[model samples]
Target: MCVLKLKPAYKDYLWGGHRLVDRYNKEYDGEILAESWELSCHPDGKSVIAEGPWAGKTLEEYIRAEGKGILGENCRRFRDFPVLIKFIDAKQDLSIQVHPDNRYALKHEGQYGKTEMWYVVEAGPGAFLYYGFQREISREEFAQRIRDDTLTEVLHKVPVQKGDMLFIEAGTIHAIGKDILIAEIQQNSNVTYRVYDYGRVGKDGKKRDLHIEKALAVTNRVPLVRAKNSYPHVADCDYFTVDKLNLDGKMMDRMEGCVSEESFVSILVLDGEGTVACGKDGEQRVTYRKGDSLFLTAGSGRYVVEGRCDALVTTIRSQSAPVRIGIDIGGTNTKIGLVDVHHRLIDTVSIPTKTERDPEDVIADVGKAVQELLDLNHIPLDACMGAGVGMPGTVDRENGCVRYSNNIPWENVPLAEELGKILPVPVAVANDADCAALGEAVAGAGKDVSDMVMVTLGTGVGGGVILDGKIFSGRLTGGCELGHMAIYEGGELCTCGRRGCLEAYASATALIRDAKRAALADPDSLLWELCGGEIGKLDPEMVFAAAEQKDPAGMKLTDDYVRHLGTGIVNIVNLFRPEAVLLGGGISAQGTVLTDRLNSCLKAECFGGEHGQIPEVRTAKLGNLAGMIGAAALLVMEG
Candidate 1:
């Protein structure tokens, strides 16, 4: 058996997908024509880990730590490696969707969100893809068509053929139709603001959620048109630059480089075979085949991809300017702050999260909170950079819509568009965990590390990732969900309708629950007495106190808890092999009492202990304010 670390599997959504047949082989050698957006491949997992301790983990987990030893080392090096690669098999029509640009993402999705390209592997007769709206529809018209189910009348459809390519920028309304296979290279995120679907029913016979208002607000009506001859189009943006190359032979391309600046490249092989030749590496070439992609880290001089097939090449460019503010929203608070262009947080503030007693009342309350913050500071909305908020869960960040947030009563709420309507500024929204991870990466312990894992030890073990210095929000916002990760079979029950999850054993809530159980079973333990003679009164802090006092029962309880935590950590480390693992939330303050034991246990459980640099178990430097700081940082970078 291969002993390795485990990584979190957030959640996956099932959509209608078509099987693709390519020249590589037959059988499963087809594309997954995405009906709805499929995330969980980048800054999360582009490729699934099929075996080892990290088996079942997303690629994002493994990439975060840059292939460091499975969860036991804490080196400071951060590798800027892209963590996601996407596949689109256009067997049917996908919804007309658009992702926000980095500015839009940072403002609305709470992170950088755009810059994507497609490499066509196969196309059926007269296959076509949707790009932008056919014409600008009035807000009233857009809403009426959405109600009338005639959204297709307003979209522009472009014919696509084999070996064709397209570069999709943020704010562009686009979709993939039937009978084509593609490899989509994009910034790691699972945010999609779908404007229209073909009224397809789900397994339960319900139509997928649609956000017409938000989509119309941000969708580009006049997107760059592509035709039969649009095979090799290059799009250059402040956040990412992409070159779509349909190569029949070896192609040599020189990338613009700056003095002492590092550049990263991702070579995606959609069909055939190819190799990336580097001059500084002494003619060393990295080879790939169909459905294969490679992330080339910063190196000097020119590079060449000499191969037998066509491929898509993507590069990230450094932003030349700076923005000054970032904003983030969460279940309990709405936060705003200031940051520099390099994504550094300088200041922040937190306000109560809208009670959202009624789902309908939540959006306006949130907007009011944001406006109040700006008003109190006497900051002009136009003068400020950008705003980012963290919605509760499973949000469509691309269009700034809250698809569904269980804790809050929101269903297809147009959060970004609504905010923009009144704020006179850009707004981004993302899941809270994703925003926190962005914050930690930009300002906290992860500042210098590009690839790292941030897990919050709270009521639930929430997770976020920074891969290649960008937050990886998976498709459907289902990435880096550590709490739901299965650590044991037939274990404790989880809130996500599952059992044996890491959260069931390791969260602060879990600790309190177990402590209460221990107190009830023994009845003689000091925990009962400390809780004022009521077992129900026990909390996580009480357990922490008991452990600190060296109570035999408390020590045993903590050991069990820590062991489970260590196991989960081991699993994440083995999968991601990140440079470091930063533990956040109130529970992380347990300090060495927790870290020392957890680290020791992890070392015992990890692969190649002592030989490999162990991942450091450090508390988050930003504390509860991390989410706020991160949101602010995201907005500023985007603004």
Candidate 2:
């Protein structure tokens, strides 16, 4: 049967007590029962099958016998079982330690790293755990504190209570405190670096080996920044997404869920008793209780859990989704991203532009980099649907050639033709701004609207108009040159040698230049403090930051920025009147600082005012890789 109860592997450590054996009904007779590997497949310890056809066999053995299809498509991406479930009963505090991230672990330990979530099944009064640092500290201080036994002073301590949950990602320094029982769901690996062990000796009469050097290298030295809203459920990472199932046996005592073909389901019961029935006829029934773990094969269809219980349900989300290659070419560097079918950038790599090199040589270097990326990911050429190129300057989409690009200093260069020689797949090329617009329209914030305009506020203000879900460049050439539109007659000189174009006043370059000029004028302003009186190092963000502090120069620069950029957007509204205007690039990082004021400005100054149907002004969802994703979307939209 697909649904089968499993037995746990026991662990006895120095700091552990008999809580697992006494309270949880573990079979272990040991005095110190530190951990129970409830749903594990690690080589060091594997849970054995307790019931059904695979009874008496290890989880690893059952998988080998039943074939990988039982594990589901999501498991296919992983070389082994991707999840490890354990019930940790700490009578004494766990050694202050950290786990390396995937890159570090794979290189040093030859395994994936740990990212775990702890559910406090039980906690003694006033129990607490260490989580990262209270504040950012220098490396020198961090080491000295460890040596002087003052590390706990800097550690961020979180009080524990039953039912509390904390996600501990790799590189986060943490430790489980005494008098706590934790159910940990993590990536299937055992690589920890103990930084401080409280001078505890092992059974061998020596202080346990501490991975101090490795811990120093991998530990995140700053305060932990938890990824906000990463998982609406219990916990989620690349390895697994865990959700809680609670049946109180009073009002709610049963739960019905479906197991799709994409991923298998693992249920680890922490409280109460229940009978889980699986399969089409619900013939497969398994009685579960506290400390019991059940595994259900993928595509097992329907399952029903009945009784009073609190359980952790773990599942993988994505399978082997098809990918597309996106190449975003810029002046200083070229970014290549592997965009999945969902339009998410699964991976990205960058190469220095080195524009001084010959065009062919530069193109060859990009080709080599793209190939290397594809190889590293174990993705074959044919696995990618196609390749898309987003170029900095005006591009002839029909011919896949960049007609002119001052950034690359290449004119009429056949970008697609050069890539086609190396990459054996269909290649599509378009202007980077247009690609950004298309990317947003197809997969980002503009995805909901068929008609939208994207304004990129970066080195130079760039815009692309999307009409009815497609990039509208107008009869092959002269269109969407948004920055060149003259905002003020006979004013600031633009890069195109025009007087007072939107780019001169609206771009980040313009902001930097204006901020530097303002800093020179207001010597005592926060702008001077921010750049340390070195006005040459002044950036656009410094100006906005100073404005936040009510500095005269910063406030004036920002106000003028709104006026000029707002004017350009108002013109766009009057011309096309799209459903939305998505603002992207580094300036957009200011978030609401740009959108709220610009929306106010657009609403007031537009031709129709309140009477007109104005577009919603929103931040672009795709951010920096918009060009790459959008360029890739062109092939899909056209195909």
**Which candidate should be chosen as best, given TM-score against the real structure?**
2
TM-score of 2: 0.62
lDDT of 1 by residue, 195-299 (tens): 777778765779888776667666666434333232234555444456665666545333222111244455555567656565454354555566555544443
Question: Which segments of model 1 are wrong by more than 4 Å?
Answer: 1-325, 340-350, 357-361, 375-378, 635-639
TM-score of every model versus the real structure:
0.49, 0.62
Worst 10 residues of 1 by lDDT: 69-78
lDDT for position 587 in model 1: 86
Q: Each candidate: what lDDT?
A: 0.64, 0.88
Clashes of each: 43, 0
lDDT of 2 by residue, 1-639 (tens): 679798999889888889888877788877789999988899889999998777899988988888888888878878778989999999999999999987799899998888888989999999999999988888889889989999999999999999989988888999999999999999898999998999999999999998888988998886754432344788776788889998998899999998888888999998889799999889999999888889998989999999998899999977332679999898999999998765778788999989998889888988899889999989888778888999988888888898999778999898899988988788899898999899988778887788899988988889899988788988756457988899999989999988999999999999999998887777778999999878889898898899999999999999999899999999999999999999887898898998899999988999978898878899999787788899878777743
All models, RMSD in angstroms:
27.0, 10.1
